[model samples]
Target: MVNVNCNILQAVDKNLMIADKIFRSRLMVGTGKYETVQIAKQSIHASGASIVTAAIRRLQINHPFEEKSLFKYLDWNSLWLLPNTAGCTTVEEAVRAASLGRELCKKIGQSNNNFIKLEIIPDYKYLLPDPIGTLKAAEYLINKQYTVLPYIYPDPVLAKQLEELGCSTVMPLGSPIGSGQGLKHLDSIRVIIENAKVPVIVDAGIGTASDAVQAMELGASAVLTNSAIANAQQPHIMASSIQLGVQSGRLAYLAGRMNELTQAQSSSPIIGISS
Candidate 1:
């Protein structure tokens, strides 16, 4: 058996609060896009994620005999089910989806069914979230006593608005959904992170471990990913690496990173060195 390091365990700060629920892991994984349920389970286990996102879609009644439901694979007791309005284009549709998600969670014995990841994506090509629709939906959900976590663009003004509107968290995309382009709007994301009072979660466009690390380093409370691990050659390994990367970045942020300098500074003593 391989020896485990106790120091590494002590270094990780595993407490994360989202919508009144405490999650041990900072990384949230998506349940879609995996090859199989077993593979998804393995990846989720390796990721050490306590929260998993699932899209709100109609169950196929035609194939009632076949086991096609995603819920069958999920362990509701351990993982917090975050149902998302991924394909909804309008505020009305998103609201309906959110309601359905809540009902579904209730059916699954999830008592704390107030959490929802609101996403209104009208643009199919870019898969960019509709800020106007998102804000409208968020307002509706918050009024309904739901803990809304709206997925939005990297706009400081919008993030502030969402926080003011009583959102549990504001999830801004680093880039387009599943683009793996990383933080294309770094300045705007930084602005959002700095200004928002609620937890800022960096969602989407994270390709690998480095992308997740960069997000955490930029002061993101958490990181959500899907395609980056699901599409990788080894999903389980990638998930584990991303988890470690997120932890390292969070530790670095807490430790206080050194300021950047334009010129290189000498490490050795110049007076003692022979010319």
Candidate 2:
């Protein structure tokens, strides 16, 4: 056996705080659209993500197959379950879904059940989140003492409004959901990250590992990805790659990247070099 240096791999102090809960991993994966629960579990475990999102609409209360239940494969002790209102089209529906999700969590004995990923997308064609309805639902949920993470367009003004409304985090989309466009509204997202007091998470349009890195380098507190990994040929490997990408981006950000220059400059000692 060869001796290895473990100090180099020591954990960094990059804890993500949402409401009162703390998570060490910044990458949040979705448990949807996978071929099987085993694949989803393996991918999630390989990704090293502490938080995973589940669609409340898809979760079956009474199913014929026990393996089909998400709870069956997940290690509830380690992973934080973030139930999302994926298909809700209105404020009322979203609010009800959130409440039901909380109740389900309670029934399942989950500790952090008050967290919700609020989404209200009435338009099916574009699948764009309805900002007005999202705001309304967020306000309602916040009033009800829920730690709401509202998904909205990459609009700085709207992000600020959500922060003002006491949302735990504001998740702005890079592009439309599942489009994999990869940060189409970079300027708007930058503005939101710069101005918002709460955490900013890039919620969608991540096509690959580079997309996740770009989002993190742009100062996003975390990133939530679903289709990118789920649709991959080998999801478990993709998940691991994405986790590395996120880690690299976060380290780069913490290292204070150099400023961009208009012209190139040489790094040699001109006086010592021969003419």
Each candidate structure's TM-score, on Cα atoms with residue i matched to residue i, is 0.92, 0.94
The Cα error of candidate 2 at residue 106, in Å, is 1.3
- lDDT tens digits by residue: candidate 2, 1-275: 11121122235534888888888788999988899888888899888899998878877744412766767768878888788999999999999899888876775678557999999999999999999999999999999999999999998999999999999999999998988888899999999999987889999999899999999898889999998899999999899888877777777676679989999878775787767
Q: lDDT of each structure?
A: 0.86, 0.86
The reply for model 1, stretches above 4 Å from the true place, is 1-14, 58-66, 271-275
For residues 61-174, write the lDDT of model 1, one tens digit per residue: 233225766667667889888889888989999998888888777767787777999999999898989988888889989999999999998889999999999999999999
What's the residue-level lDDT of 161 in candidate 1? 93
Best by TM-score: 2
**Residue 67, model 2: Cα distance from true site in angstroms:** 3.0
Evaluated against the true structure, the overall lDDT of model 1 is 0.86
Candidate 2 clashing pairs, residues 3+ apart or interchain: none
